[model samples]
Target: MDLTMSCSSLSLLFFISLHIHFLVPGSGKFLPFRECAPFVCGDKNISYPFRHNERPTHCGYPGYELGCDGHNPTLVMESLTYRVIHMNTNMQILEVARKDLSDDLCHGAHVNTTLNSSLFNYTSSDLNSILFYDCDSSPIFGSYPFSCPTSGDSYFAPVVDLEHLPQELCNFSVLVPISQSDEAPDRPPPSEDSDFGAPINHAARISEILNKGFEITWIANTAQCENCTESGGICGYDWKRQRFNCFCTDGAYSPTCNGTRVPGSFPSRNKKMGLKVGIGMAALGAGIVVTLILMRALIKQRSVHFDGEMKIEGLVSSRRYTYKDIKRMTNSFEEKLGQGGYGCVYKGKLGDSQLVAVKILKKLKGDAEEFFNEVASISRTSHVNVVSLLGFCFEGSKRALVYEFMPNGSLEKFIFNRSNTLEVDRQLSWDTLYQISLGIAHGLEYLHRGCNTRILHFDIKPHNILLDANYCPKISDFGLAKICSRQESIVSMLGARGTPGYIAPELFMRNIGGVSHKSDVYSYGMMVLEMVGRRKNIEVAVDRTSETYFPHWVHRRLELRQELGLHGITNEEDEAIAKKMIVIGLWCIQIDPRARPCMTQVVEMLKGSVDTLQFPPKPLLSSPSRSLAACPCESSSLQEGNDSSWGYSISIIRDRLSL
Candidate 1:
């Protein structure tokens, strides 16, 4: 009898232990529903779908976890952390503001606020407010101008005025969503006779709108949660199964807890006890595997967050296309317009029947930064003389830039006697060439001073300039461009950049001077000389000793007051235009950076007559001794020591020309 009683006690204890284990959450068994009592998080009552991190996972919906920082509640969505200012459970809306903007609006990372569309969405009452940073001038439209001691001037305006925001005057911009109600309370109604709309207190108005925060409604399993709650069960989530779970006092159910048994719930007490133990063991093993998979996914998410790919997407205003879309638009890389070291350009048409040139870049390792730089630099520009960026494609290693198509193709074929029908048929006249030169000068001037941020195009050559249907020159190919603040006259660079023959002396030889906009001026000078002479600056000869540098040849002729003996100069007017171009090109190519004229001065000189312009000093050195045949058109990594070969004297040519 004693032995039998001991055996019965052991059996009871084993059954009780199994029951308790099944009652616990995440055991893949029946989870008992306990009252998920509401708690205060930073003065706001949090409950149901939104729960603090200290609570169990089943207490809240997935991706809705909140953390407390001091006296405020913080939430992170789409990798951007925000402070929760208010929560309305009934309306299923949350009001939150960016933590970075709240702390330091001036120095925060220049990124737009992005939310997970699957989990939350902005309310209809919200309006986009843009902040233009490092603006050189105020907006033409009504705006609230503010200044940061370290960052310079900035402007804030609504999305309605975005078209008139003056992108040329701002170095960076960020889009922020604000409630229209917030603005309505602070702003006075516009008067009929008012020139500048309503007067606003800059600090108070902006602060109130930002601090009050914007509203976004949560949509994660809302209907299911409501159904579960109405069925007398606590709303929860089955993270392992990735579905809604309804918990009651006895066990967890799929949709509700109205006497429905979960998959692994305990069988009736009369069923076999051994079957229950086997099911429990299998569920435990499956739980471990699911947990491991989730952990790996979490690690991958963190890696992507730090990679900065999302940041790049958020910063650019242009449209983004996938690799498949690129192939479809290009018709499997058909109709190649041109090819270069960086990539190949293909003619493609958009859905709207708009012609575009898709430049597909080569898949080179560690060129991601260059691709990003090109996108960032060119997207900020808006000028008649600059190529328009329509869209872009960035997928893994496949990258491409989509630009408005130029019917005349690159200026290279036209300037150089390339064997193309378009080049022969559309031969550029002297007047047309002069207009192209003036247009290029205007584009450079806009890059240097017209924009809030100065852009230095290290590679400025005819090959990079595209001509439109009307023969208008538009500066293209910003692959080697450097963006700097307007205040930064000189910029720091890791190494020399630009085509070999057109690279400024300061780039390869640091002792000459710091690299600045004047470096671009040097490149422009070489290109103009090439256009004037209708040949390369340095031409390869059968013997290196007899090689002729075009700039040296042109300067010699100009010094002797000789007629520019060249093709296409049929009249005195043509000769005058040629003389004016040669003089301006010479002034731009001065060895000393300070001696080189700025783009603004170059534009003014181009507009003026040849008689008013004085002769610029002769260049100190001719072309380097290196053979032009071996150098590629795009050589960006020329070292400083290589300058030794470029010390050839021009005295021999000068004396010969004087005689």
Candidate 2:
């Protein structure tokens, strides 16, 4: 009977131990194990969403837990070891390099990468997919001519073009993913001659690419975890509770860390067991508390950047890059294309061989507001005439915008010429000029009416027009832009915008009409006038003989039905284009803001015949008083129009006439 009672007690004790391990909730089991920083392995600094060995399961999300193997922080996801390089909370990116792969990466890269499908996915950045193929000498070998030689006869060749390999010599294949630097030169297409081999160094390039590491973005079922992570709290999903838990420095919190003191809200465990667990737990807890207090004090002494603005809420769709990434893309800003009041632009290349122009804004008053404004406005625009906003970087005070590179540069150089002897073939033809004019008008119309909101390009001038390789015009420079609802007829502004010659009269003083899209029309008109005369309208040095304002002279000549006296209007068609542009310009530059046609009207007028256009009255009389010839056009003024300006080359005119 004594042995039976002893055995029964032992069995009951064993059952209770099993129950406590799996079911009973304890202070240490549910709570974070009193740690401020999550990591100290190698050079890695671990933070939110990723928990280390010192942390409880509640401190980090599942599939993101990391273990330390000696000096390296190893992540065992999808049954592979990935060395943690860095983790960025703002970017929500985790970069990990393949630890199993050899350092040389070329001769033998048997290691492969796969993300935790439940929680993460590979970043959408362009990656080169390398497929390893085993092959023997056969007719099919020519398709995959380039080889990764292994044995004396057999080789591993990377075949990109071919889809299938015949059973005669083919063994098997495996695919590997590698992240590459965006600045790598584009590989040229393979030649028809296979034996010549590929130009790009596939082995060295790909190995370097793997060493750079890969990015995986976490995806939780709900934004609860995202909010918790953003609030500087560790986010972890409770497998047993089937809900997200935000763990703060104090203790495990609900929804978020509200700064309230710790409380015993957890399910109660057996009280008899508390003393046994409490004595040892109390000793460990006291040591952890002291360490945490010292760490908190040290961390508080460090300085923090004013980078909070970079994490603008609701700006997630656009890719956010680090300052280091920006430097790499721009090649340390080595090739500067141009510099303006807003920023400096540099030529750059993306990993996929696409050329780009990166604009780094200068630090100035209202820099933060302007940075966000430019991003917000440009990101909403998607048109052929509008420059594309590819990506952006906002780390601390350094901010930048990446755009598609326009080889031809701004239209200022093409339009503004100092010399009269420049050749004609080198210049743009009247036909091309008309099409570009029409394209600009179409883009303007889209911004005004087509977009969900009206975008008023406050500054529209020759300098802002950008031309592509095909001479197609695209509007750029949105530093002075404004957005208003379609219903709001007139937009509000504190002061006048645009360059001296291009700004509308009403913007300076609301005498003509309230500021509206019509203001953009006025600027466009001045630019079109410059395009026709091929010289500055007010006081350009193209010809010294004429002191009169240029547009007034063109108006008088048109009123008299006289010859335009343009150098490039050799043929009937050339003359017709010149007349069309002149008529459009005269209408756009009218002093009365109401008198100027909307962008929609301008587009139609450019498409219509020159004969249908009515001569516009002289606009100078309605402007602020200025010294000029009493008449709109005099003999001297007409002669000045006849002077060979920078463009309007005679050969180009004659060629058009001959055609």
Whole-model lDDT for model 2 versus the true structure?
0.63
lDDT of 1 by residue, 424-534 (tens): 565789999999999999999998888879888898999999999999999999887888898887765423577777888766443345678889999999999888888
lDDT of 2 by residue, 480-514 (tens): 77877988777644335678778886664333346
Candidate 1: regions farther than 4 A off: 1-311, 365-367, 417-426, 541-547, 622-659
Candidate 2: how large is its RMSD? 24.1
Q: How high is each candidate's TM-score? A: 0.51, 0.49
Separate clash counts for every candidate? 0, 2
Model 1 TM-score, all chains together = 0.51
> Candidate 1: global Cα-lDDT?
0.71
